[model samples]
Target: MDDEYAKLIRRMNPPRVVIDNDASADATVIQVDSVNKPGILLEVVQVLTDMNLTVRKAYISSDGGWFMDVFNVVDQNGNKIRDKEVIDYIQTRLENGANYAPSLQETVDALPTEEHTSIELTGTDRPGLLSEVCAVLAALQCNVVNAEIWTHNTRAAAVVYVTDDSTGYAITDPNRLSTIRELLCNVLKRNNDVRMPKTTVSSPGVTNRGRRLHQIMLADRDYERVERSGMGRVDDKSSRPHVSMVNIERDYTVITMRSKDRPKLLFDIVCTLTDMGYVVFHGMVSSGRTEAHQEFYIRHIDGRPIRSDAERDRLIQCLEAAIERRASEGLELELCTEDRVGLLSDITRVFRENSLCIRRAEISTIGGKAK
Candidate 1:
């Protein structure tokens, strides 16, 4: 019987949802593990919001195509939701499918007013950067009207236009404005700027810095040559990835990724390929002052160049998504205060009541203070 179930699970790959009662706490805990896809987190949160349940603490992590997320949730009045039927309903909804479209009634009833506001954010890029910003805005009930993002010199800058979803008004509340500024500053400043790490060059030819300079020169020369040959378009922005095939006595495709210099970028790209079941044969990685470029000669593990147009397009899409996710995954929030028994849980309960979800947290105490 166990073996049969195991085989069934392998074929289905279905999401697993578990709701566990926390006797020591006022919030019920829910855990979900599933094959990760875009918008999965959003769907879960939307369902909870629609049910009028408040999310107090959440931990979200995705490795390759698998994700695990845990949420602490409570009723709108900050009471534990212990009713068995309700619990079963919630679990069923989460496991049923991702096509559940939430109603707009909650947004309409949230805080209706009319205001338009603009905010500018600049910081080092990381995975999930846009998602984090958008999540913050969503938590605050701010609706994005328009936004633009650009990356250059290892920095990301965004200009956002938003309006209050409830009231359709600009964010004029001083307290809300202060909260927005503080939260965004935390997200932007907590991580180091995305730049190449220091390294030693034992190569007989040149030092690391000298090699980087040469790579930049080579990149510039190649750009000019491409323009002269009329094979590629020139743009005013920093470089993006260019993927193509090799036709001359080689059975591999080449992927050229050029972006603002970032740490562990190659690791992220490699992980994406591994997830897609591809194998790398030969590769070259180089860095410029504020940019990095990588070229990989690769083929499917079954030893075939990506041939189908659909598969090639998916490869490019997944690579871009992986890079973007890595660039934005540095979002975090920090707290510091005096410590006491049950203080941490008490704080989390408050966040839950206020409808603020904590995706992840690190806590420690020093000098009689909790941080």
Candidate 2:
């Protein structure tokens, strides 16, 4: 039986060692002897399974005996064991013994939230720049999710991930957004306008003085009338109020201004005119500023030309207020073509006299005869 056991152990390679000397007369002696040959106690389990021997109730002794899969055998009580049952036993033991790996679901569920928003800011890079930005965000109650920042020499860019609070305090308001942009511009200007100290030395006979100067151009008027004169014709009868069409017998006016002044001017002028009870039928501002200028072409709902001096004065005042507001904000303001009489001729004359180049021009009027 000892020789048979030796042959069996040589064939089977179990992960652990086990020996069964059931009710043998020399059981203790045989167990002691079996422990002497470690190689015989460590054969492959696959070979044992292929051999068809009932490896019943195998267990490793504390003294380094041969290994066994308990489910590959029948117990002394005649109960059959399954491979799955053995696997479950092994898994539970490993988990309890601190050698088990986490499942995929467990890993993923432990990750952070996926939703986020990004804010990008770029300007002159300086020490404490990031700290200042973070301070502002904290004041606004924004929770930073993730961020990546990089700076090279003197330039920097940052992508900030943020989450807005329920009170909407985390996100910047429209006015605050504009203010932030202006603040960034100011910061850049500070870096760009740094002045260097000047040095001077005495010469044997000649003296030199370092001179610095700055100049800015100022126009005599904030606004200039663009004459759209001699382009088309207008009839006298068609110029009357309630007339459906203003006969294009002569010329008409189309007003324009600097591009930056377009919006505030348009809104203020439209509001003022509407408040003064002048019905504006159709109006459109040419696509923003082209060639450093923008045009607001408007037509009165009434076909009659603006006749009274009082009405004209009121219109001029509205235009002036719009221009002045924009100018006070450091914007350039100008008026082009607001007169209907000989407008085309006057515009041509002004452009010629000033030597101003005309890149592109458009003309339209309400109740004017079709070209």
Candidate 3:
């Protein structure tokens, strides 16, 4: 019974806990019932609290047939907590001579039904990996409803349930699902010993991007225009997109975009380059009513172009599509370049600070010295 209670606690990641123990002849009950000893129930409460759970109340009933213990735990802020509520119930059963703990599914079902999408991720743990995953999910507009993470003996596992407030886009479309999977795979591949299996589950009633055209159309118009300019010609055959690739022997690259395009759009564009096999060594974005531009100096990871002209062109098309989808109402995007000294130096500073190094450089200027 004592071992069962321990197992139950391990499964529930509660925010707070309060327990009442009913005195029984069982060793487990006796240990908990011995409240007079320090480091017993109080110790358990401390451990739970350290895990960010709060126990507000407890009750013990040793009467015949009514022999049970009850606890009232809430979130840190005193909200009613439910994740560990079942633990107290399980303790009651153990006190009544139940020898086995509940099944994993049964225990999971005992909790409240809040709206959330559960994702199971297993991989090698590294610094900043979790943050990167969360950032991608946040960028996709997924709200984290709950998260459970465990790492033991160098193995890491995470279970996250995400939900949106509108509840309209729960989970739909294979392309978006594939994109997420690909992103996770790429991130894991960067670390040794980290491998993720390809399996995803989407909750019903979620609308995927293919069905959310209206939301996509909210991007800035100027960004859409520049993005269109970046697309490849129809004749291109590469599976990726076509964009200018300059090997930076130096440390960075400077890209100029229209003032109407937001910094966020510029960042997305650079990330798109990465998705297309281009590794950004350094970059920066500046935007104003009169000027909006991003400068990136990057290098090919394998010391060669990752995408052919045709493939690069396709990526450019996708960038245009994404910009058009994210374009804000009434903003005009127009990009033009002016000459400046040490332009490369300034751009490299941004990249260096971000831990990117350039292996080549490409510079283009209009109405200014070409040198």
How many pairs of residues collide in each model?
23, 28, 42
After superposition, candidate 3 runs with Cα above 4 Å error:
1-114, 191-199, 202-371
Candidate 1 segments whose C-alpha is farther than 4 A from its true place:
1-250, 328-371
> Which of the numbered candidates is closest to the native, going by highest lDDT?
1
Q: How many residue-pair clashes does candidate 1 contain?
A: 23
Q: Which stretches of candidate 2 lie over 4 Å from their true place?
A: 1-115, 166-173, 184-189, 193-371
Return the TM-score for each candidate structure. Answer: 0.31, 0.21, 0.29
Predict model 1's lDDT versus the native: 0.54
Model 3 clashing-pair count: 42
What would you estimate as the lDDT of candidate 3? 0.38
Model 1 lDDT tens row, 1-371? 96676557545887899898863376788888886654455456555654667555555555345767776676767778878867877777688653332433332112212344666666544445555666677777765543344433234455454566777557777787778777776666644333322111111221111112223322222212112122122433344544444422447777777666544355456556765677665555555546666667777877788887878777776666445433432235567777544454455556655545433233444445666
Q: What's the distance in Å from true for residue 214, model 2?
A: 39
TM-score of candidate 3 against the unseen true structure: 0.29
Tens-place lDDT per residue, model 3, 1-371, is 97676556534522222243333221122122321111122233322332333333333322221122333334445444334555565444333322223443333211212344545555544444455556666656565544444322222345455554346234455676677667766665533332333224455233211112222221111122221221112322332222344333453332323334332344345334544444443344344443444445444445344335664445455455433333333323232344333333344355555644222122223235322
User: What are the per-residue Cα lDDT tens digits for candidate 2 across 169-262?
Assistant: 2344556545544553444343342321111111111100000000000011112222323222232333111101231232222343333322
